[model samples]
Target: MQKRAFTLIELLVVIAIIAILAAILFPVFAQAREKARQTSCLSNQKQIGLGVMQYVQDYDETYPTAYYYKNNTATVNGGSAGGYVHMSVLINPYLKNAQVWVCPSDALRGVGPDNPACADWTNITQIGCEAQVPRLSYIPNSSIMPRKRGPQDAPNVVSMAAVDAPADVIAIGEMTDFSNCIFLGSTGQQNNERRNKSHRPVNAIMRTAGGGQWAGQSVADVTGPIFAITQAAAQGAEGWGGPADTRAITNTAGCRGSAADGGLHIRFMSPGRHSGGSNYMFADGHAKWHRFNDTINPNRFLWGRTYFPSGQPVLDQAGVQVR
Candidate 1:
C-alpha cells in the first residue's frame, strides 16, 4: 500500500491535465450545441416555407397579408378580410407539430400567458381580436398585393395572382418576441376604444403597423419609445420594415431624425437573432443570410409592386424607388 501512493507533484500534474482537457472540451461541446440549435431553426423555417407554399397553392397563389385596417375600424379576425391569414394558421396543418412555431433560439419563448402554445395560431385575449399573437419565427412576404379599398366601402380582397415576384423579394424571415408588442407601432387616436374590438373575422391578419389606444397614434407615429430617433438610428436606416432593415448593427448616417423613427423604415431594418445578419427566403423560395449593411441595389430586393399605389415605386436605398 505504501508503494502505491502517488507523490504530491504527480497528483498536481494530473489535476492540471484534467483541468486543461475540460477547458478545451467544454467549448467544443458548447459550439456543438449552438450548431444544433441553428440547424433546428433552419429546419423550422424550411417547414414553414413549405406550409406557406401549400397555402398559396390552395388559395390561388397568394401570400398572406401581414396587416389590415378598415374605415376607422379594425376588421373582424384582424386582417383576414384582406386575405391576410396568419402564416401560423395557414401552415399549421402542414407543419403537423405546433412546437415548430417557437424557435429554440428565441429567449422570449414561454414568457407570455400562452407558454408552450403556438403564438401565431392563437389570438391573445388581452390584446383583443385586432392583435393576434404571432409565432415570431416567420413572417409572410409583405410585398404581395394588398386589398383595394373603395371610396365608401371596405377594401375588396385581391387575389395573390396580382403580384409579381422579384428576384430578391423576401418571402419569409425571423421576427421578434411574439407577445412583446414593441413592434406593433402606434394605434392612432387617444383612448380609442374602437381599437379594443375583437377581430371581425375569425382568421384575420392583425395589423402589424398599428398600436393600441394606450400606445397613441398609428404605429406609424413617432411618439413611442420604440420609434425614438436614437432607437431608430441604432436599429439601422429605415429599420421599420424587414429583417435586413434592422438597426442591430451598422447604423448608417442616413438613419438620423424621422427616418430613424419611421415605421416603414424600422420594419425594413429589423434583424433576427443573428444580430448583424438575418435569414431571408427569396421569392424563388431559396433562403440565405444577408448582412445589415450590405449595399446591394434595393431594386433587386423588390418582390412585388402590386401592393404599392400606382407610380409609387417601392422605396430602396437612398429613399428612391428602385423600379
Candidate 2:
C-alpha cells in the first residue's frame, strides 16, 4: 500500500512537461489548420475558374459580363441595360457549390448588422437595376469587355473573351461591396458604411466628377493608389466603390483596401491570412499563393482604360501589369 504514494514534485514535473509540449505544438497545430484552409480556398478558386471556362465553351468565345445593368438609366452612353452577369453567378453552375461565392478568411462575413456570414450566401443575390447594375464579390477576365456603347449590354451576355489561357487570365478578385456597382460619378452614388471601415480611402480614390470632399477623416484610411486598368474598371462600376468585405478574411490584419472598382479587380480564392498572401487560380487551372505585392510584370494587371472615362492602372503586389 505504501508504494502508491506520489510526491508533489512528480505531479509538478508532469504538469511542466504538458505546458512545454502545449507551447511547442500549439503553433504547429495552428499553422497546419491555416494551411488546410488555404488549400481549400485554392481549390474553390480553381473550381470557379473551371466554371468560367465552361461558360465560355457554351457561349461563343466571350466571357460573362462582370456586372450587367438592368434598365437604361444607368447607361454611360445609352447602352442597353439589364442582363448584367457577375463572375460569381456565371461560375455558380461550374463550381457546383454556391459556397464558393465567399472566401473562408473574410471576417466580415456575418459580423456586423450589414455583414453576412459566409454561410448566408444562400440569400446572396446580384444587386442592381437594368440600367444601373450592382457589384459582385468576384469578377472574371472573360467578363472584361471593351467599354464601347453598343449592343453588348444584355442579360446573361458574354462580352469579352480570354486573350490568353484560362490560367493566364484572372477569373475572380475581391469586390468592395454590392453597392460599388453603382456609378460613382452620378447621383446614384450612395455612401457605403463599409467605406469608413475599409483600409483604403474609398472617397479619396473614388474621384467623383463633382469634386466633392472625401468622406471620413480617419487617419486609418490607408488604401493604396488605384492602379491597373481592369481593377480600375471593375472598381468604376457603379457598385464597385465601397469598403473591403472583411467578412471574407474575418481578421483585421489581413484586410486590404478594396480593389479598385470597375473591371480590374481579380477575385481569387482565399482562406485565412497567408502572411499577406492570397490564393489565386491561374488560367492554366493551377492554384498558387500570390504575395499581395508580387507583381513580376505590369501589363498582366491593366484594364478598362478605353471603356471608362478614368484611365487608371490597378497595380499588383509587385507593381506588375494587373489590368
Candidate 3:
C-alpha cells in the first residue's frame, strides 16, 4: 500500500461542506442558547417569587416595603434621610442565593458577585454600596406600595394580604437597566446611577398620562434623549398617590422623554425579556411569562388600576391610599 494524502480539491470540498454546515447550524445553535437563557431567567423569577412569598409569610402577611428607606428619604440607600435600601436584602434571605436576583441574559453584568450583572445580595453593606445596583435584574411592583415621591407620612407599606387579584397582579418581574416607576432601589434610583450618565433617566419614554407627575401626557408626545429632559421628565411620570395611569413597554430600548411641569403620565412598564414577553412573578406566588403587548395595552388589563390593592378611584395628592 502506498501512503496517500487528501488532494487539494478533496480538501477544498470538505472545507466547503463544513462551511455550509456551520452556516446552517450556527443560527440553530444560537437559538437554542437563547432558549436556555430564557428558561433560566424564568426559573430565577420563580425563585424570587417564592422568596417574596416566604418573606410575606414571616412578616405577618405584609409585603415587604418596596425598599427600606433611610430616615425619610427615597433617593436610594445612602442619599440622606430618604435613602432606599435594596429590596433584595429583604427577600434574598429567603432565596438563600443572591444569584436568583440576576437574569442569565443580562447585558450589563457588573464586576461583583457571580460574574452576572445583579445585586450583591450575599454581601449587602449599605444602600449606596457601589456593588449593589449592577447586580439587580428584577424590580418589585410599586403599585402595591405608597408613592415614593409622595408625602413622607403617607402609609406606604403594601401587605400581601391586601393584593386584590393575587394571581393576576405582578409581584416582581424583569426591569429595564433603569426605571422611574415604583420599586425598590434595585430598579429605581440606585440602579439609575450605575448606567451611562448620558442615559440618565433611562426609562422615561414609557410614561403615560394620569398621575399628578405626568397628568394628561401621552407616551407618543414624549421624545428625545432622556438626559436632555428635566429631572422630572427624566424620572418619567409617576402617579404620586395612586397606580400610574399611563402604560409603556417592558424594556426601555426606544424610550425617550422629559417630565411635563404638571402633566399626568403613567410610568410603570414591564420588561419583555423573552421572545415577545417578559417573565413575571404574580402576587399569588406564581411565576409565568406574559406577552409584551399584554402588559402595554390597557385593554389587556395586565398592569394598571386593577393591580392596586387600594380600591379607591384615585390616590390623594399626598399619595395616600384611599380605600
Candidate 4:
C-alpha cells in the first residue's frame, strides 16, 4: 500500500470546523458553569432564609438587627468601644454551618478594604468569616432589618406579622461589590454611598478596625457604616421608572452624564450578573433567582413595601471585583 498524507486544505477545513464548534460550545459551557455557581449561591440563600425563619421563631418573630453594638453610646474611636455583632453571627446557631453565609459566586469575597478571598473567613471567633467580622455573601433587607450604626437611634425593626405581603417582600438578596444592604435608593439623598458604587457598609469605618477588635466593640465606634444595608441600586417607588432612576439606569451612568464624584456612572449593575439576575430569599423563607430589573418591575416591585430613588451608580467606585 502506498503511504498517503492529508492535503493542507483538508486539514485547514477540519481545523476550521473544530474552531467553529468551540466558539459555539464555549459560551454554553461558561453558562453551565455560571448556572452551577448561581445554584450554589441560591442554595446558600435558601439555608439562610430557613435559618432566619428559625431564628425568628425563637426570637418572638422579630427580625434580627443587621448589626448592633454592645455599647451603642460609645463615642467614635473611644477606647471603651464595645465589640460589635452582625446578623450572621446572631443566626449562626440556626444555620449550624458558618460557611452557609458565603455564596459560591461571591467575587468580592467579603466586605472591607482588606479584600479577603471567599475562602479566607475570620478566625478570631464570633465573627462571620475566618478573618472578618461580617464577611458574607448575602445581604439582609435594611427596610426590615434597619441600618443602625452605633448611636442612640431606636432600633427600627419590622416584625414577621407587620409585613402586609410577606411573600412579595424581599428578606435577603445577594451582595455584590456595588450592593448596599439598604436596597435601591440610587438617587439623591437616598444613596447610601453619597460618594459612588461601593459596599455601603464596608467603608472607611471598617478599615479602621481589626477582626479581633471588632469582636470586642461596635464597629460604629470606630467606623461610619460597617454594617452594610442591600441593593441601594438605581430604582425607586415608580419601580425602575422613577424619574431619577430612569436618568440613572437608561444610560451608561458615567458615559451619558457625570456624577458628583467624577467617575464612570451606571445607574444599575445587575447583582446577579452571573445569570442576568440574582438570587433572593423572601420573607417567607422561600428562595429563588430573579432578574435584577424584574425585581423593580412597576407591576411587581419586590425590594420592599415602597421604593425611593437616590444615588448615582458609579461603576469605578466599587473597589472590588464582582465578576
The best candidate in terms of TM-score: 4
Q: What would the per-residue lDDT of candidate 3 be over residues 1-323, giving only the tens digit for each residue? A: 99999999999999999999999999999879978988998898888778878988898887765544343435222332233445566676787676776787655431232112224433434433322343666656654533232233334466765666678666666654323332222234444322222101112212222222321112222231111112233233332222122233322322323222232222333344466567877777888877644544333334433323333222222333222
Worst 10 residues of 3 by lDDT: 197-206
lDDT of 4 by residue, 1-323 (tens): 99999999999999999999999999999999989988887888888888889999999988876655443445432111233446776777777686776677775564441222124332223222223334566666654565444554433455777765778867777654443321333342222343222222211111211211111123243233221112333332211212221223443332223233321112223244456677888888999887665664434556553211111111112322111
> What lDDT would each prediction earn against the true structure?
0.40, 0.37, 0.47, 0.48
C-alpha positional error of residue 31 in candidate 3 after TM-score superposition, expressed in Å:
1.4
Task: Name the weakest run of 10 consecutive residues (lDDT summed) in model 2.
Answer: 196-205
- Candidate of highest lDDT: 4
Regions more than 4 Å wrong, model 2: 73-85, 110-166, 174-272, 296-323
TM-score for all models, in order of appearance: 0.57, 0.54, 0.61, 0.62
Candidate 1 lDDT over residue span 1-323, tens digit each: 35788899999999999999999999999868766776676677667667766767777766554433322243323322222223455456666676665667665551221112223434323222223334345544433423222222223333434445534555555554322222222243222122211111111011231321111113232122221112223243433322344332353323222322233322422254554455655555566666544423343433333222121234333444444
Better of 1 and 4 by TM-score: 4
lDDT for predicted candidate 2 compared with the true structure: 0.37
TM value for model 3: 0.61
